[model samples]
Every structure is written in structure tokens, then in C-alpha cells.
Target: MKKNQFDTKLIHEGYKTSEYHGSLTPPLFHTSTYTFPTAQHGEQSFAGERDDFIYSRLGNPTVQILEERMAALEEGEVALAFGSGMAAVSATIFSLISTGDHILCSKGIYGCTYGFLEMLENKFGIEHNFCEMDTEEEIQNLIQENTKVIFIETPINPTMKVIDIEMVVEVAKKNNITVVVDNTFCSPYLQKPLTQGCDIVLHSATKYISGHGDVVAGIVVCKAKELADRMIPIRKDIGAIMSPFDAWLLLRGLKTLAVRMDRQCENAKKVVSFLQSHPMVKEVFYPGDFKSQNYFIASKQMKKGGGVFAFTIDGTKKDTQEFINHLEMIKIAVSLGDTETLVQHPATMTHAVVPKELREKMGITDNMLRMSVGLEAWEDIVADLQQALIKSNSNTVC
Candidate 1:
């Protein structure tokens, strides 16, 4: 099947019922270990002579189905599932480089990702350099002989900064470094980084991929068979594989990804428009907005601006708090890409782990708000924001 037909592929690309008594849906193989028919068969499985599952930590049939479906969605050679998004990120990074190697990363990434890299640098001696990564010159200047990987998060968490994937891939190729893109925001429906020459794409499937926000999972999709092969052992040794039930939930989530994302994107566009025109909103950060700094890049690489965007209120941190507190329809939350609209303050919530000075340097200000527009009616979402702004302004004046 052609991978380009994404919506069709989402439902039909991964599993076939003929292998499991024509059940229609993939079954959750809840066993921890698989039994071999004979002693020789078990020996063969251990000796790598037989392609079979031996243990759940190493592999599971249900998890494999989800991996295959995600691979198809991302147009990747293979994919690996993890218990959580951080496991996928850490395992993939550990598999690619040794302790002495250096990594070049985007400045505005997820707070947990930043914390993980810092821990790796301090504990394992792996080095990392963080920069805006908005230009080829910036990337070129940061490249060092010891640099082994270039990691980036486009439409960066909470800030919505869009990085140029193709340009970064070109720079990595020139430097003989691997490029990994954290595609949690766009998912595969909106953007496929592998097709843009990125070596690997990672996702926090707990977000858009699992649209209902019920499961916490992560996946790493590899463009090359060799990279997938290298990552498998690391995942097995770390024992961070996804459970069969979580995999099943993620599989169900994949089926509706195309549809859920379409509506969410539509809602986000309307929200951006409302925020941009509001008097209390100082700046709206959405790549889809024509006035955005990264609008051109977002237009070139993504099908639509994703559901999440950031905006700044024309007031202090207290005003921002008032705005969030006054919000009646939108929920104050950290994670994005859910069925319900969510809002968060990065400086106090997501990026709190980073030093205040560094957070400020990354453009995550105290007054900034990150919003994840949901499947709610656009009018209702707008009205909620309108009233919240009015209430916040009124509170500030009094």
C-alpha cells in the first residue's frame, strides 16, 4: 500500500486478522514469556536461528503491531516502542553515542528533555550544546569535532518555534552527524521528518498519537534498518518496553489520528486568530499565523499548524495567573494534544526544572501561556478566552 494515503494507512496498514483467527482487531498478547514447541525450538530462539518472541521485555506481538503501524505512519524502516517518551529519547540517544561524544540540540525543547541532557552531561560525561537553531550559520558555528548527534524539536514545546528540518539534516550530513527530531507536536499526520532526510523521528505517543490522552507511551522511528537494529538491544537491556495493553491503546489512538488532528488543527487556527486580535494578548506564537517568524518554514514542512501554540499576555506574571484562573472552559494543564483544550504557564510548570535565567534566555517568559486547542467548538473556545482576558484585565485594574 502507498504510504502517502495516510488516513487509509492509519486504519489498515499494520495488522491482518488472518494471523489471529480473523478477529479483526489485534489481540493483546498478555503473556510475559512465549513458549517454544520443543526444547530445540527454544534453543533456536535463543541462538538467533528462529524469529520468535522469547520475553515481553525484548518484544511482544501486540507491541510489534503498534510499532509496525507507527513505522508505516512515519514512513520509517522500523520503530521501537517505549514505556514512556523519555525512555525512547534516552535509549535512542544512548544507542547512538558514547559518553565522550557531544550533541547539538535546539534551545527551546521540552523541560524533561533538557533535564535529561543535563543529567547525561553531568553523570555520564556526554556533552550537549543548546542554541536557537534557527539558521544554518548557527548550527555550523556550534558543530564540533566531538559532536555526534543533532537533536531538535520543531514547534518547540510551549514556545512554538519551528526549526528547519531539511536544513538541519543537510548540516548533519555535511558534519557526518545523525539528526533526531522530536515530532511530538506535529505527529506523523502533519509532518514526517524521515522524508525530509532526518535519520530518526521520536514521539511522545501520549499526546496526539494517542488522541484520547489515556496512555503514556513513546516511539522511535528509524529511517535505516541499521539504526533500528542498534536500538533494539539497548531497549531490551534497559527493559523499558511498552506493555501489551498500552500498545493496544496506542493502536486504537492511531486509527483516529488523522481525523482528530484535522479538527484540532481547525480549532487552533480559530484560537490563534482570536488571541491575535485580543487587546490583552501582547503576542501570539503560532506558526500558522502569517505574522509568525517561522510561518514560512511551518508552511513548507507541515500540512497545518499543529494544535498547540504559545501566547503572551500584556501584563505581569500575576496577570497571566489571573487569566488562567479566570478561564472557565480551558483547563490549566501541562501536556498538549488532548481532546480537551489545555493551558499552561511554562516558566512555572513545564520549564520549571531549567534555571530561571536559562528559561528566560530560551524566550519562555513568566507571562507566556501555551495552549493546546482541542476538539471543542471553535466559538465556545473563543468565548472562553474572551471572557478570561476581560476578567484578567479587570482584576489587574482593580
Candidate 2:
């Protein structure tokens, strides 16, 4: 119809107030375990004959509601929640491949995700390769017999590079490789990777999905029930399941996701425009910007220029840090998707775990700064950033 289905699904999906004594809000089921009516009932649950929850580690009512809601929002067959974004990443990888398998990834990814990939190679025989994924030839050339997963982050972290999801999926389908997309930056509101023929879509629910600084959570949505069935045991055994309260909080966050993301994306465009025109900004990496290399692909994939962007200052690392220090309003922090705008130096902060040479290959330079725009007024954000740039100018000789 009008395409307002998503906004409505965010608030009302997977929740029936009548199921909870007519309470307007979904009641939080905060308990460690569930009691079975009898030994026979417990046996039925343990044997998978009943849908009753046996323990919180395995499942919970509140968490189940969140999972159901997220599945609907992301257009996936099923969804699972995790304690942290890394937990979701680790579990999904562990579930999908064997010890000797290989993974192909986007050149730029979250610093922690990079770390986890390294760990996989070191501890296990599982290896990975990085590709720009710019063309079908490039993707086909990189595929190996052992490559089991094609993991990518579109509008990739720090660099804001947007890969064509359908292009990757098309090549992946030919080889029977699982396509896993990290949708943390876009959230389901902007892009639905599963609908583009991906196998799994993931998110650091701590960011845009939660839309606040308070919660740390993750979600994994699988297009096929068979794929989700494979990951559930991993989540349970790893013991990284999301807490009941976190699920409750996320449900609250999802209710406002459409509004919060709309505001943040709008503010980000205005801020990026100012920075692009500013003298101190040498380069800007925003998916929505017409000048960006990724602009066309992003326009084809994403609904908006997401809330995050990156840029390089026309100065030294010292000058860059000085600019961040001089900001009076925008906070110098690594996390994003909060009500307050946040910024961080990728080379020294979030992506520091990645080796300097490798980080450079990913275009994460010392003078580069990544910002997550918030729900603040566009004028105020631009004004604060302008003042900081002015203060940083004095730190350099020019």
C-alpha cells in the first residue's frame, strides 16, 4: 500500500496486549527459569515436543518477543538475539563454517569484527581474504573451493563504502556460498539485505536498533529456517544470549526506530554538507553525498544516507585530536546511534586493533574521523563542528 508497513510493524508486531491481561505494553518476563507442570511436561520440553521454555539461557518470553519482532522488521524467516554484537558475529561464523573453511570479506569492517576474523585464522585453520567487491569479476576471482561464507559490511564501517548486495548475492548463489551481511550501520529501516537474496543479516542492536547509548545487544536474522536452526545451538552453547531486560529495552527502542533514524539521517546530511564545504575537511565519505564513489550503489540499496559518516582532516593526527578535544557539544566517543552525536578517530580508537598497514589498506588513516549523527538540530551540529575546526587550525603552522 503506502509503504508505511515497516513503521507500524516496529511498534505492534509480535505483541498482542490481549495475551498479557490486556496490558498496553508487553510485560517483561524477567526470570531465570520456567516451571513445568510435571516431569512429563518437562520431558516433552527437553525432547522438543513442547514449545515451553526450559531455561533462560535457552530462551525467554521477553527475548522471544523481540526476536519475533526483529524477524518481521528485517523480513527474515527467523531472528536470534545475543549479548553483544561480537557474540552474534562469532556465533554466526562458528555455525556456518568448519575449521578448515575460508571466508571472503569486505575490505573495511568494524575493528572488533576484524579482530574476530584474525582470531578465527590463528586459533583455527579457518582463513579469510579481503576484497573490494567492486565487480563480479573481482568477486569470482576471489572465490575458492573452501570459501564457505561471504561476509560483508555495506556502507562499510569507517570508509562508508557501499557494496552492491545483489551483485555479491548473485555470484554467491552460483557457488552456493552463504551471504552474511552486517546491517549494523543501516538498520532494517534503511536496507533489508535478506530481501536482496542474502542468507543472513546481522546488527549491533546497541547502535541504531536500540537508538540510545544504554543497551549493548545484537541480532541475527536468517532468511531460511534451516540456517537459523544451525545458529541457535551455537548461541545457546556460547552463553551469549541477550538478557530479558535488554530485550525489553530493545522492544522499546524499536518502537521509536523509524522516528529516531529519520531525525538522525536528516541531521547527518546537513552536517556532511557543511563539512564537505569546509576548508579543513580534505575528504568526506558519506553514502548520500553525490560526489562519493559509493553514491550510486548506496542510492540503489539504502533508503537514506545513514546516521554515520567519515572524513579526513587536512592536517596532522595531532591537529585532528585537537579538533576533537575542542568540540563543546559533540562527544569524542567510539560508539554511535545514540541521541547525542559521537565521533572517534578510527586509526587510534575503534580500528586500532587492526594492524596499521592493514588499516591503511582499508583507508583508515590517522587524520580520518568517523561521526555518528544524533537527533540534535542540524544547525547546532554544524556550528559545533565549525568551532572545533577553527580551534584545530591554530594547532597547525598554516
Candidate 3:
């Protein structure tokens, strides 16, 4: 019943019976069109005078449960689910940005988000500033009269830059700018940005929240009911609505989020430790390391250090490729936050679209490997990395 507890809320918060037997889970309403009782009833539904499901695109019982559950977890007034993470990002930005408006965004945002923002700027006459600096003064300096939004990816992708959400929110509030945080990396289990003053929080549910690689979904959570209502039309018009089947899958995934993230963070800690001590590791970037400059800020806001960390191999690009090629257990992959461990090189993969100079400046190098520690045994993962590192050095002069 309280906001602090996640497991209990995940299982019981969203669903209640709807004119049927008290079932534990909401029934999946699979129909595209819902029949109205009478002509007056249909009219009211069509005219938005009554809150009832008219079409699957507008709303569905099963989808609503997922939305409600996510909203509750994120401490938001409402939520909107999408077919994928990009859909949520697009819908949210499209809802806010108008012609001649400007956006201030973090430089190390997800590659696709950067692309989307650029597209809007180029075509819609909107302006944007991508800054590595997230300090209040840096942000304040960038804000113009037409600045409408301040977007950030705290514990930013690839580079893992931790932004102070409260500080940024405070600055944005003074400027009448909306703040949006991409919570995909931390998920709601570890971080709730709205509680820390973010106006909206978005997640790539395909990652941690789903806890499996089988589905691709996204969710946007916000404190403003009006924003949620506005998003609904865009979601429907753009046809980014999450399928009832995907919603059901996401609901099932939510049941295990707390436990999965617990194990994930545990495994990640071990991986970070191992990487820090390894001779072939250049640097280990995880928020849990207390010695890290960002550790205190991360601890202040997030419940856990999160499950993913970026580490650069103490070698050239060729040597890094050799290590990845020799890995026994950890699979080299693009996406993360699954039941299995995933490793990727952001320079050649996720952030490849970013200009080379910008990528290097963000600390995403060709030799850098971004890992998503999974629910795997710590010892097993370590052993695999040990063997991989050994193989990477077989041809090197001692």
C-alpha cells in the first residue's frame, strides 16, 4: 500500500476485477472494438463524456493494468506504455516540443534519442543543446526564453555519468522548463526520478523491467494527469500502443523485477570488483565504487548501484575484439538487462551513429565494453572473463 515497498505493490497494486469474479489478475480484453450497451452509451463514449474503452488503440483493460502498475511504482500520476522505448521517447518529446522551442539535453543520451532530437530540430525549426555538463550553472547558461525541456540520462548510457536529478529539477523549475529523465538504466526498482523532482520518467522496459529478452516495450510515467491525457492522443495517432499480449508479458515480468534486480546488482558488484583488479582492465565504471566521484550522488538518489557498468579493456581495439571473441559465458550483444549477461562495444554498436569525436569525448571508446551483469553466478562469470583475458594476451609479448 505504501510507495517504498516494491514487491508487494508489483504483485497486487494494479489489477482488480471488472464486473466479474474476483480474479487475481486482470483478464485480457482482446477485442479491437468494445460494444456499447445502447446508442446513448456509444455516443457518450465517442464524445469522451464517459470513461470507457471504445477501441483497443485508445485503451484496454489489460494495458491499463500495466500502465497503472508502472505509474504506481514510479510514483507518477499516470503512465503510457509503448511498443518500444523509442516510441515512448518520441511521443513524450512530440507532446512537449513546438516550433521555435529549444531543448537542453545530456550529451551521453541513448543514440536513438540523440537522433530523434536532431530530427525534430532540423525539420521543426526547434533548437537543442547537448552538453556534457549537468551542473546548475551550465544548464542555466544554456536556457533561453524558448527553452521548454531539460532532458537527461542520469548514469548516462555507455559513459555512466551521474546527473543530480534534484539539482537539475530545481534549476528547470525556476526557468519554467519541464524535466524528463530516461530511467531505462536504473528502472523503477532502483530509482524513481519523480520522487526526486523529475516531471516525467521514461523507461525502455525491454531491458530491466521485462527481465527477459522476449519483449520490446517502453513506458512513460509522469506526475501530470494532463500530460498523460495529451500523450494518449499522440500514442493512438502514432499507433505506438502496447499490445495487450505485451502488457500481459510485462505484468508477469514486473512480478520478478525486485528479485531480479537484487541479484543483478549483486552480480554487477562482483564484476566491478573483478574488473577493477584485472591487469587488462583500463577503468571500471560502476556507481557502487565508493571511491568514485559520482558514488555519493548516486547513493543519495538510487536505492542500488544498478546492474550495468562500463569498463575499458587495457588494450587496443584489436585486443578488445580478441577478448570478446574468446569469452565463454558472457555473450557479446547489443541490448542489456536480460536473464543472461550481455556485453557490447558502444563505439561500434549502440553509440556508433554518434560522431567519432563526440563519442571519444563521452568516454565511449572502441576498447570499452559495456556490460549488463545478469542473474548469473558471480564465480562463473569471473572465470569466463579470466579465460577470455588470457586468450586475448596469448600473442602479446610478455
C-alpha lDDT score of every prediction, in listed order: 0.92, 0.93, 0.89
Using lDDT as the yardstick, the better of models 2 and 3 is: 2
Instruction: List, residue by residue over 216-265, the lDDT tens digit for candidate 1.
Output: 99999999999999999999888888989999998888899988999999
**Candidate 3, after superposition: displacement of residue 356 in Å?**
0.5
What order do you get sorting by lDDT, best first?
2, 1, 3
Q: Which scores higher on TM-score, 2 or 3?
A: 2
Candidate 3 weakest ten by summed lDDT: 16-25
- Candidate topping lDDT: 2
In model 1, the runs with Cα more than 4 Å from the true position are: 1-4
Regions of model 2 farther than 4 Å from truth: 1-4
| Candidate 3, 37-123: lDDT as tens digits | 999999998998999999998888899989999999999999999999999999999888888899999879898998888888788
- Residue 157, candidate 1: alpha-carbon lDDT: 89
* C-alpha lDDT (0 to 100) for residue 185 of candidate 3: 91
Q: Evaluate model 2: give its TM-score.
A: 0.98
Q: Which residue pairs in candidate 2 have backbone atoms (N, alpha carbon, C) closer than 3 angstroms, thus clashing?
A: none
